[model samples]
Target: MTGDIFSENHEVEYYETNLLGNMTLSMLTDVIIMISQDQATALGVGTQYVIEHGVTWVVAQTDMDITRLPRVHEKVQVQTRGSSYTKYFAYREFWVRDMDGNELVHVGSLWVMMDIQSRKMVKLDEAMVIPYHCDRVRRIQRLNKIPKIHDEHDIMQTEYHVRFTDIDWNSHVNNAKYIGWMVDVLPYDFLASHVPTEVSIKYEDEVTYGDPVLSRGKFINTDNQIQTVHDISVNGSTKSIAEVKWKKLDKKGSK
Candidate 1:
């Protein structure tokens, strides 16, 4: 359940990039998440390892700050570490840095273990978490709360049918895919001319394969940054909420 920092080198794949050849927010988050899973697997605390015990980890929230998105074909080092935990939650950190060690993005995430059979969250067993080496914390971190998208807000909406590829080991839409849904609802010009500086997502429920999701968002231009609020709805219920703050790219495509 506990371990030291882990890292790996990766090339920004062509498929991972946006039109500007920079990695998309969804793929950037996905790569770091994969790094953490690799670390967990190496430490004998991975998804397969934990599932055997009738429980699995689920991401409850993610908060990230981006200095810049890496370009396609660029090699970067990604690192992850288990920071600490409380009775019911664990905090993990991930960061991407260029070959020269310049930090590009920093992320913090909250995870909780759920009983696979019961489909309910469970308490962290003191003994099970020892391998992660995370300190025992009395309190949970207050990650940035994603603002709710209310009925009054005029929203842009996009519908996506959950595909088989979107389901992970948990048999549900992976947390990283929510970013894709959120980003897809934005205007092509906006997405092309701006880069996200911050992203916050909070997952409230699981969405399974074959479900149709209505992703809706409202973009607010305030000061120098454009702030966007989003909600993912399945049926008529909200499953996830997210917020992203973007910095406009100038004429030369530099943020």
Candidate 2:
């Protein structure tokens, strides 16, 4: 709902930053997710509550727009809230800003309830979601969709085994780990020289602990923006897809 917010102040941890001393994309994602979870628990509908109800929350898609990334040792305010919801999807928004209140990042995501036992998507439960106080609309909100990678040649790939810590209480590799794997496959030079302006990612299947997942990515150059398409797979089956657009970082390290 409008103006409803769950906010927190955080000092960027050194371990979460990259070589440039700025928070990595995965860490940024984790920060936002943490706030959302905090909000849920505060409202008495957190992980344990949902698990007891035989369901778990799952993010189906995410769209992030970056203005600037908070650097190591920087203090920032992170806020999140339930924006709106439909019969099957709960839409949420998040923001990160410096102490001066300048926006560093904005993100939107779509989530659904999944039956824990069946691991299948389930319709949203009104009694459970009522705590968020978001409007329920008959029509689904429009979200930026990632295009299908149609026969995009043999792609550069990296395989990593899911570790014990990678799997969350939901018994699946956390979504942020998938994002990290996707970006990690890109060239170091590209990752270092540019910053993402737009990002779109969707989750299709979950990877469990000990599963070897392959992250494949290919760059697409254009006159205006450098773009990349990525897919995470397990045993040759696609589990997630992502597309990212980047702008070159200036000499001062700001886009």
> Cα RMSDs of all predictions?
1.9, 1.6
TM-score of each: 0.95, 0.95
lDDT (0 to 1) per candidate? 0.87, 0.86
Deviation from truth (RMSD, Å), model 2? 1.6
Stretches of model 2 off by over 4 angstroms after superposition: 1-3, 252-255
Model 2 Cα lDDT, one tens digit per residue, 52-127: 8999888888898888888999999999988888889998999999999998888988999999889899999877
Error of 1 at 237 (Å): 0.7
Candidate with the greatest lDDT versus the true structure: 1
Candidate 2's TM-score: 0.95
